[model samples]
Target chain A: MTLELSTLVAILAMAAATILTRVSGLFLIERVKLSGRARQALEAIPPAVLMAVVAPTALMTGMAETMACAVTALAALRLPLLAATAIGVVCVAVLRAIGL
Target chain B: MTEIIDETNTGQKPDAGGFMDGAKAILPLIAAVLPVGLVYGAVAAGKGLSVLEAALMSALVFAGGSQFVAMDIWTHPASWAGLGFAALLVNVRHVLLSASIGPKMTAFSTPKKYASMLFLADEIWAIAEMKAREARLTPAWFAGVVAPFYASWVLSSVVGAIGGALLGDPALVGLDFAFPAVFIVLIMNFWQGRRTGAVLLASAIAAIGVKSFTGGAWYIAAGALAGLAVAAFASQGEKTENGETVE
Candidate 1:
């Protein structure tokens, strides 16, 4: 596995793009005049992306995963995030273990 | 601008204990992140990336979710544009994370601020915010907590890479569950408040819908846009409510 020139360039592009995002919030808030609605939207983006990333995969993986995620969501309301995550992972691992 | 300017903590103490405090705060999260980093390294190795590529990404990008997403689509040089777009979109949250910490950070010098940005991540932000609730937060504290987390992630990537090389299959023992499991943990933190549920549903619908129709990054981007659009309305109601309303 060697790094091709295109791959290297792509790597740099990604690094640059990520660096901008890392810095964007601090600077964008200063330059960009945001409406109340826009503020709401920006605030919501992270959670939305979180859903988008996991929802599809969980739905597709199996019934056990869907159930596990639901368990995690419930755990979220009661326990710490890591604890909720542990519950979900354990749920899935157990289901998979039982060949569900 | 007024709000941001108002948040500028002028004449504050440039304290050093934050490093120690932050270092202490992130201990639990380190336990969670270490396994995920190992999984990422193994996944990268499974995908045929050299050790350097895997290590550089973990060290430079330092974002677990975006790194996982990028590696899922990783195919060397050709996948950069697609990877960049998706990863950045996934990282769009960082803009918010940095903003939340930005005011406290305004007290730092320019070079110090820039150096601290390299250590930004969800767990770091959460710990910093949690600490700010009780005491004054310093850039040093933020930087200190981030150090161990960064080391944990990068080191685990190397470890996982070695494990993948030796084991031959990263998912041979169900280690593939790390990605979604990590996301589950993260989303839990963001799951509170009224509008969060609505936004999550809309985003999930958009993501699943787009994924069923297309094969690229459309799902993630579309889901994000859909959620934001819904949020435009939902967040306003939450703000006016004047209380934390959980549904």
Candidate 2:
């Protein structure tokens, strides 16, 4: 595919926006002092925010995909994180191969 | 007491142990990011992006999810305005993340802040939060943790892009599974105490809710919002029981 200048620019801009989000947190967190309640809320944010992000992707894929991911997540809980991920990817491939 | 004093003094050089501590703390995070980096590489190549272009994207922008979203938009030939709008929606969460980390970074110089910001990711932020709790805010320790994480992301992206070009259909070999697999691992890492069960329940509900109401993109957003709302409510209840008001 021929590269369009516009596509290139858009991709770069998107990348910048993404980085800004990640860095903006560190930058701002240092400049401002958060109160205790704010701290508690901030602490709670990650799991909640991440669950929101990951849940839809895992479930919407389909029943088999969701189950497969659950198995992987369960395995991740028990085993080393990296190993569980490898196992999950393998499971996905094997299932897809068998027409799941 | 002397050991604690020595540790607290930034002027004293940290021995090899401190470096290793930093490395150990960041390793799992690096592992979590690797697969995503590979997927980014494969997707960019599959979309016919050049090596320099893809690598630069990872290096400069460095946001994994947004990069993937951008790539999806790239393939569709949408208007620049549409692409920008979509990108903004996806990244608005960063404003919150930045706010959480802001106060912890006061000691860093302006240049260091600007440069280090480029390496920020969800995993890195989690790791940095822990580090900040242990040490007084200093640019050196921040760099010690973030530098490796940033390098891993950029390097893996390059590797993934190259691998993507070579592998062709990533799904054939199951490389596409890498993305989700990485998240499963990360979610497990963040799952602790009651938060684990709560997150799982909320996610399951949100997933179903979003899937029924909208397709994938909106599904993700709705699901995330649902999870956040549920967590916020739960946290508020806990605070009330403890005789504190929720902020």
Candidate 3:
């Protein structure tokens, strides 16, 4: 019900920082021409970044998380996103429940 | 039924397909994000953030990863400078995301494109990039994904803030894995055989290595850069194999 000044300032600052990160890429894209290795690099960004983001959880978290990640990847190949995710979640929950 | 604003003016009125396609495509992610949002709101509440504050942060900042990091580092008499810097570091990946997707938004006008960048959450960007590979990425479609996802995030956070304490640990049921699970699925979608394998391998090695040592958000940048380097090198190998002279 109440908003404090310091919290508001922090939130606004975070918002500003986020907006800067989001929009700066547009400026970079506008300035750069995509071709050759540059195009390859840009194309790789999606997978590379996604892999980077999830790498820790997939490989380093624990046996349960790693196994669930593998299950999800396998299911993703044949199943819809929702089904694959559900299987992964169920796999991890079961694995965790068993004290993995 | 969200009206899709056709940014590419072919004299087309707002069509339902443009928006509906996007909404349908992002529906799965919405399901995944709901729990995550609830967890975030609960976390914020646990960190002593008021319900209004939690809702405001979710509505304004809108990036989940950085918001979580912010909560981790949150303090009374909050340091705007510290939180702001952390937000930048965690979300620096968006630079690559927006750069990759910017040129693909052929359907968006310059203003519209810039506007859309503000809402470029990871799920939205990943889905949009996938769509662009197979079809045209229209503004209406982008709006459809953003609107529902954004609303769900903010609303869920509000609900969590109000009642998250009663929900107890999300991990007991493995709701926490939803994010990485969804990410794994997206990575599978983006897989392009062995070259992608090389990229992923380099990224995973670098990410794990850096995470083990430095430990923070730097692992993401390190892994992403390593992957990019491998890709650039692989492309160079392709050029040489094709007998194309290197510049």
Candidate 4:
């Protein structure tokens, strides 16, 4: 499929923005030198950041779907990460197929 | 874990053994990241992007979550300004990730630092932190570990995107499960200790609370904000009881 110039521009811009987001943290952290308290706060950022990304999809996706995903995720936690992800995927697909 | 970092030598040669160890350390992370890469591939292709553009994105941009967000927003009827704004908002979290790793990466050369920053995802950061602590490796070793993982991610993304273009049903091959499964494993790692358990519970609750009020992308920002607030309060309380600041 051929993409429009506008779409390509948007994609590239988005890519640039995303890279900037990841790189910016490393850049600023090295230069700025955060203190003890500030470092603690930084440490806390991941869970919050991840929740910011994961919570919405989990909650908004409906109970069965979310629960299916969550259960599979929980199960995956016990296994290797790859295996766990695979389990979650199969769980979701199978449950969806069975009309759960 | 803390002892490992404290006891190990900070400077070590990057031997064949070290590279292999790095590769093994990153394998699970790669698996976790691959599914998300596939999703990005499928969406990018489905949205009518050419293979070259998608590959370029994987090579140059390399941020998985934000790339997915950008691809989604690209299809929206919003003006370019709106799309840019949305991408920025979705990616603002990276600022936090960068901050978390910044202090630890200070000793590297400019190019090494820049090159290493490319692979600093959640999993990579977590693994690097653990390895750094355990091995007491210098910044160079840290780079050696992260650089290969970064290359692998870009390669997988390109392959996924190309595969998405060729295959009629990429989902049938089970690429869609990567992100959620990876996330689960990551979260499980966090949930191990009591302190981490509290953090996870609080973060999950905060995320759900924010997601209820705001729709779409706002949930991420709100959840993160809520989590920060909660963590700050908890940290301060710990300080008060201990009569000493946490380092």
Highest TM-score: give the candidate number: 1
lDDT of 1 by residue, B1-247 (tens): 2232322454354445656777888999998888788889989888877777788888878888888888777774457788778778788888888777766664466566666766778888778778777766666677679889999999999888878777565443445666786677677677666578788889989999999989867788899999999988765454435434333
Best by DockQ: 3
- The regions of model 3 sitting more than 4 angstroms off are A2-7, B1-25, B69-86, B104-107, B126-141, B239-247
- The residue pairs in collision within model 1 are A7-B77, B18-B141, B19-B141
- What TM-score would each prediction reach against the true structure? 0.88, 0.78, 0.81, 0.77
TM-score of chain B of 1: 0.85
Task: Give interface RMSD (Å), model 1.
Answer: 2.1
The docking category that best describes candidate 3 is medium
List candidate 2 stretches off by more than 4 Å.
A1-3, A23-44, B1-25, B78-93, B192-216, B238-247
Better-scoring candidate (TM-score), 1 or 3: 1
TM-score of 1: 0.88
- Candidate 4, position B175, lDDT: 51
lDDT of 4 by residue, B96-139 (tens): 76666655654555565566666666677778778766554445
Tens-place lDDT digits, model 3, residues B152-244: 999999998888688776678886687678778979998876788999999999989998998446777788889999988888654555434
The deviation in Å at residue B141 for candidate 3 is: 4.4
State fnat for each of the candidate structures: 0.62, 0.55, 0.81, 0.56
Off by over 4 Å in 4: A1-4, A30-38, B1-21, B76-87, B136-147, B165-177, B192-216, B239-247
Model 1 chain A: which ten-residue window has the lowest total lDDT?
A: A1-10
| Per-residue lDDT of model 4, residues A1-100, tens digit only | 4556766676667666766877788778667866556655566666666656666556666554587568766785467766777777777677656665
lDDT rank order: 3, 1, 2, 4
